[model samples]
Target: MKHSRILSRATAALALAGAAGTAAAHPGHAASLADGLTHPFLGLDHLLAMVAVGLWSARALPAQQRWQGPAVFVAALLAAALASLGGVSLPGVELSIAASVVLCGALVAGAREIPARAGLALVGATALFHGLAHGAEAPMGGFGGFAAFALGFTASTAALHLAGLWLAARLQRLPALAWSFIGAAVGTGGLALLAARL
Candidate 1:
């Protein structure tokens, strides 16, 4: 029942963000890796999911296994970016990326820990979708710049995850509830981003 409620809310939220721009939307009227570097910051869906990767990693795995989750996500992200560069296309990339935000946030809020292998699979799968979405949005005729953008976004994503991981680690030390609440906030923010589209 609880899962259903969260799913519905997440679904509703994705529906909202669904209407937002479907593309990565960058390097227009300018050409630089800097633009690509800042692209993820341009959208809430991307931003939340990237950071949630970090948060989910911290909460879902043991200390030694934490880095594994982000690693898988990033590797897959790079592959997807390459695929996009090669002119590959996938349907519903935007919606899937948004759904990742919902799922990652939910995982954090629930404090559901799982095996490292399983966690890596989960984050990796979602990351492929995200990579493809970002790749698809790369500026045409600017592989060098787009590569920079890819590097930019990938680096940004890692930083976001690190931020999440660090905060959660600190929060886990406190008696007060912190990480769980932040997860809820992340989920809630995702919903708003989705809704803002409508």
Candidate 2:
């Protein structure tokens, strides 16, 4: 694609991101499909990590199996969220989540350096942590409510992954410096988030 098209897409994506309603990490807010849809965009950690997963997959995986990364992540996220609803929980979840952003950003930076299987494993593990965090803040209603919220968030997360993939596709023509800058910004944001949590 031409630079103009790429820049247009980027601008549109940024506009949408800016326009979305923001949710706090672990807000403990009421759960609904709407809330769930907006949940992934609530925190930069979640947004950045989720998008980075897509970006890494685009850079690291063969075209034939590129979808696996997002598939595994979505599956793990849903499964983990369900597990949380079943009264299971993990400790140190917040810190792990923050670290996931850092790791994901790094993964995107050096996606080709890691083996594909290793990358998938890492992405899956990161999704698990994210799922646990999302589950922890599920709505207080019965399973029905949780189900709605889960559906909403799952859809949104998948969309974000697609957005990342699209962005990565555009990045293919850009110079290495562009990738490095993106990775650095993402990693630095994660670090800031991690420090705040500490």
Candidate 3:
């Protein structure tokens, strides 16, 4: 019953986000709080990577350390976004973000094989690129506007991660092979997006 409720909520959230409109590669559609909240949903790469982080966390880490993955990712994401505001830059942001999807998905698929700390590190590192991409694309604004956007973005991102974690929990009933297949699918999707960008 609890599992069903969690799944239902996650599905509802994804459905609502999917209804938000077309997904694009950082078109800078709008810089408002709404945009920040919805921006991660607007991009396939961001959505996949964020969710995969949660999935990987739940799959690989012990229950006690599960929060570390999301914490590291969110911190890195915010740091990179803030750094970009200060004129810091990372080359090939789009490519890296795409790669994050692929790598994160792969991690989910093979969560048992990798060490927990290594997985956490990879998540944090890739998040930097995501942060840079989001930061770079966001329009210039005063501190107030940026702060609002950041708050919304951060909240939305954490929600997505929770969704992934919930999904992982629900999937525990499934065979390991099934979980691996899902991860492979996500990785394949990332590859397709990467090819499009390249």
List candidate 1 stretches off by more than 4 Å: 1-30, 174-179, 196-198
- Point out where model 2 deviates above 4 Å: 1-23
lDDT of 3 at 53: 91
> Model 3, range 106-180, lDDT digits (tens) per residue?
898899999988898999998999888777766676667777778878998999899889888876765577667
For residue 3, what is the lDDT in candidate 3? 47
Residue-wise C-alpha lDDT for candidate 1, range 1-198, written one tens digit per residue: 554454446434434443443443332432457766777777767767777787778777878878987788889998998898798988777666667776777767655645557667778888898788777777677678677777788788888779768756644543224445556666766565545443
Alpha-carbon local distance difference test for all models: 0.68, 0.79, 0.79
What TM-score number comes out for model 2? 0.86
TM-score: the better of candidates 1 and 2: 2
Taking all chains together, the TM-score of candidate 1 against the true structure is: 0.76
The digit string of per-residue lDDT tens for model 2 on 134-165 reads: 88888887899998999999999999899889
**Candidate 3 CA-lDDT value:** 0.79
Sliding window of 10 residues with minimal summed lDDT for model 1: 21-30
**Clashing residue pairs, backbone N/CA/C < 3 A, model 1:** 16-194, 17-194
Tell me the deviation in Å of residue 176 in model 1.
9.9
